[model samples]
Target: MKSAFAAALAGAALVLAGPALAADPTGLWQTSTRSGQVEITKCGPDLCGRLVSSEGLKADPALKDVNNANPRLRDRALKGLTILTGFSGGPDAWTGGSIYNAEDGKTYSGTLTLDGTDTLKVKGCVIVPLCKTQTWTRLR
Candidate 1:
């Protein structure tokens, strides 16, 4: 009876923990600004995201990276721009990444925390104390 009860308890625990343990960040997500969608995928051992669509893209089909710091890259299109790069961590959280903001023409050190299965907390900082956080919702 004791062994049977213990087995059942373990099974229950596993089922309860399943979703939290299986938080997969690879998917389409809407930016917090509601201005664009990013498709996140596995890149090497890290995760990265690319801009698949945006309000700006809809207005101008041939939108370029006009604000990019690199003058040579100014001609690159924003349709498939790599905005998130080199994020490495776990099933629910990630760090050691760089987030590029075309609006400001800057890249910041970034960290991501997957909140539940649908919400993601994205943070970027120029320095430790100077950080901004945004909530991104899963679109797929």
Candidate 2:
């Protein structure tokens, strides 16, 4: 009877500690420039991110997607834009993604790496060695 109780206790502990052990990037994160916050969520077998909120949009209600390369989409609202897509990898490292730069209206190869419990490193590469990285802080 004592062994059974101990086993149940162990199982309960595992259940409680599982998330803490795994590196999960799915959460609201503030961009390094503090211009916007991106919400990362699981999309099928991969991960995707969207611009949920932006300081610029808040300050100017008339802001639109003027920087989009496609002229038709330029009139669309900047909110809820899918800026990151096709990321596929483990919790600690994600690759093979495309990051859309709304400011420049360009896309680049993207990689995401979890730095710690509250920080994420987002890198966009024009080429393998030529990359720009930004540190994002988890909001929740």
Candidate 3:
């Protein structure tokens, strides 16, 4: 009877600890400026983030040559881009992923870390390779 009780307790403990061990970043997270939000979901063994909401800009902008020198910058779309991928660092953080900056039409390879229940630290850079991090709050 005691052995059976111990086994049941062990099973209960495992059940309680299971979800904590697994990394589930699925949620709606807001940007620092509250200018936009991204929905992060599990994509196979990896994770992918998509733009879900925007404040100051339209959903889709027209591809025009307002700034004639940069054609690629003018034609870039801010929505529906896979901003994060190949997360293989650990349970709480993601490393070796790319972040797309639609404002400049540039993609930077960087790392992401979960700071709290509603905060994500994202850092990306260009020339120096030293990332400047920003805390993104979870919206929902």
Candidate 4:
């Protein structure tokens, strides 16, 4: 009976720890610049990241046109669109993903890696690839 009880407890522990081991990057994160915060969440089978809040953002003088008429800026979307998508690799890392830069309204193919419990590195680029990398710190 004691052995059965021990086995049941072990099973329960595993069940409780499964989600943590899954390594889903769904949480609030602070931008590398320490200027804003973004919320990364799972969208259906993929992942989507968005700006949850920010500081030092001008209300009158717009920093940049996110959705410009220029073809080069077509992939970029307003803060409303999911910036991170098409993630199919794994919970700890994602490939074949795209990140939308709202500041410039440019979309670039990218990859994401969960650096720590609350840190993520998102890198995207144009010519060199893996040119622009930002370390996002998780927020409570």
Winner by TM-score = 1
Q: Quick one: ranking by lDDT, best first?
A: 1, 2, 4, 3
Give each model a TM-score: 0.86, 0.86, 0.70, 0.72
Q: In angstroms, how far off is 80's CA in candidate 2? A: 0.8
Question: Which ten-residue region of model 4 has the weakest summed lDDT?
Answer: 56-65
What are the Cα lDDT values of the candidates? 0.92, 0.89, 0.69, 0.72
- Angstrom error at residue 68, model 2: 1.4
Residue pairs clashing, model 3: none
> How much is the lDDT of residue 76 in candidate 2?
81
Cα misplacement distance, residue 18 of candidate 1 (Å): 2.7
Per-residue lDDT for 4-102 in model 1, tens only?
A: 999999999999888865588999999978478999999999999999998989899799999999999999999999999999998789999999998
The Cα error of candidate 1 at residue 50, in Å, is 0.1
The number of clashing residue pairs in each candidate reads 0, 0, 0, 0
Q: Candidate 1: lDDT over CA atoms?
A: 0.92
Task: Report the C-alpha lDDT of model 2 over 1-21, residue by residue, as the tens digit.
Answer: 999999999999999887666
Rank list by TM-score: 1, 2, 4, 3
For candidate 1, the 10 contiguous residues with the lowest summed lDDT are: 16-25
Tens-digit per-residue lDDT, 7-57, candidate 4 = 999999999887576577788888886376777887888777876555534
Estimate the overall C-alpha local distance difference test score of candidate 4: 0.72
